[model samples]
Target: MENLSLGLMLMAVGMITVFSILLIVIYLSKLLIAIVNKVAPEEVAVKKATATASAPTVIDPNTMAAITGAVNIVTGGKGKVMKVEKI
Candidate 1:
């Protein structure tokens, strides 16, 4: 019927329009992300905070005592830490 053909044509036009718009949006979003990454990129935090690998780490007596005390309490005085390292 003519009415059925007309309805099918309208539906095809609407679906094609929606798909075209969605494709444009996807490409635009990808382009924006690429622009942002090129202009101002995300920096790694680990590179900004680093210590000399050659120097030994030192802890103050008070900090060491507190850490040992906490460990002792947590372990019910059954374990002790031989060494400590800063990560």
Candidate 2:
């Protein structure tokens, strides 16, 4: 009976010790992150100037016809090419 009680006590102690160490590690890591962030803050990203819209692209008749034909074939004459844009 004494041996069983000692075993239970040892198990409880080990579990408590491990739990305390894990909690300490987690809190310490959080503190370190906070300190580092305060010391060297992240830089704000610069916004890029957007490209202006140019003149409408002109599609040649042959290329337009080919695109139209492909669309018609894929959609069984139900689809229409409304606008074509170059990459």
Candidate 3:
């Protein structure tokens, strides 16, 4: 029937239109991201040296004991605390 053929044609046209629009939007978004990155690139973070960088940090007796106890409990007494340092 002519009506059936017309309906199919309309559906095909709508699908093609939506697909083309979606493709255009995707390409445009990629272009915008590339343009923005080129205009203002991300900066590399610089780490500043601490004043006590050369000196060794001393851990409190209580804090050290607590950390050691926690590690032992978590690892079922199989883990050993070789070094404890302050970040």
Candidate 4:
């Protein structure tokens, strides 16, 4: 019947449209990843240069001790503990 043929044609068109959209999305993601990778090295170099241009600063011993103490408390001093205890 003519109606059956029209239905088949519409189904084919819908499938084709879905496939086309999927391929477009995949292609765009690949393009964006490539662009980011290409530009990343230059961006990193700029950041490093800006960081190096800043004057070096000294840390206070008290602040360092407090930070280390907090980390040790959180970790339960596991890092300093001898695990094997080799005799």
Clashing pairs in 1: none
Which lDDT tens digits does candidate 3 get at residues 1-87? 999999999999999999999999999999998887788654421212333442567676898999999999999999999998777
Q: Which candidate comes out best when scored by TM-score?
A: 1
Candidate 4 structure quality by residue, lDDT tens digits, 2-87: 99999999999999999999999999999988998797658788777756653353344585677677778989976442222212
**What ranges in model 4 sit over 4 Å off?**
41-87
lDDT by residue (1-87, candidate 2, tens digit) is 999999999999999999999999999999998987788654421211122222356676899999999999999999989999878
Instruction: List, residue by residue over 1-87, the lDDT tens digit for candidate 1.
Output: 999999999999999999999999999999998998788674533444333432477776798999999999999999889998877
Model 3 lowest lDDT segment of ten = 42-51
What TM-score would you give candidate 3 relative to the actual structure?
0.45
Q: Cα lDDT of model 4 overall?
A: 0.73
State TM-scores per candidate.
0.45, 0.45, 0.45, 0.44
TM-score pick, better of 1 and 2: 1
Residue 60, candidate 3: C-alpha displacement in angstroms: 28
Query: What are the clashing pairs of model 3?
Result: none
Which predicted model would earn the best lDDT?
A: 1
Give lDDT per model, in order: 0.83, 0.81, 0.83, 0.73
- Deviation (Å) of 31 in candidate 1: 0.5
Model 4: weakest 10-residue lDDT segment is 78-87
